[model samples]
Target: MPMPASYPTYVPRKQFTQYLDDYVSHFKISPRYHRSVESANYDEGTRKWYVKVRNVSSDEIEEYHGRFLVVATGETTDAFIPEVEGLNSFTGEVLHTTQVQIGKGI
Candidate 1:
């Protein structure tokens, strides 16, 4: 008996959010670590995007002007973490992708 062609096909998740964080880390570039873009405003006259980036090291702030803005700022940052019971007092292991991976990890 012949089976339908679509029987064993595979379809990957269209959204990267579905993938595990560690898996995404394998492909991240080193030299260019994550820096959250606090805000972005575009200038039509110059065709540049003025982005305010926070320096995770010294907790300083800087601005960058670029012709093209990729806006790689994923959905991770857009949402807020829930504060469950005893969440603040828990000492073991607690981490946010932003605090740990600096926003690069999915």
Candidate 2:
């Protein structure tokens, strides 16, 4: 999705977060946070996507059907750091993509 014109060229972390919150609220999008997808399968006959999601907190599983299913992992979940030779010896700072703050010398 294109960024809104009102957004500054270098949007701050909080501002970007607020923009997302506003967009979701304005669009009445229902996002299920903290839920893990157990399975996702597309049905050609019905042309719909069937997905099974499990709530991480309550351990409850639920089924959902939709025209589209988005799998957005990684950034919402834990950051993975692969082991590299001499990484510990390096003096430079290491930050994940999600940890980067725009216009802050990232």
Best by lDDT: 2
Give the Cα lDDT of each candidate.
0.54, 0.70
Judging by TM-score against the true structure, name the best candidate. 2
CA RMSD, predictions in order: 14.6, 11.2
The number of clashing residue pairs in each candidate reads 0, 0
User: Worst 10-residue stretch by lDDT in candidate 1?
Assistant: 1-10
Worst 10 residues of 2 by lDDT: 97-106
Once model 1 is optimally superposed onto the true structure by TM-score, how far is the C-alpha of residue 51 displaced, in angstroms?
A: 0.5
Per-model TM against the reference: 0.38, 0.63
Error of 1 at 96 (Å): 25
Model 2: per-residue Cα lDDT over 34-103, one tens digit each: 8888876667688777889999999999999987654443565577666654457644455665675433
The alpha-carbon deviation from the true structure for residue 85 of candidate 1, after best TM-score superposition, in angstroms, is: 33
Clashes of 2: 0
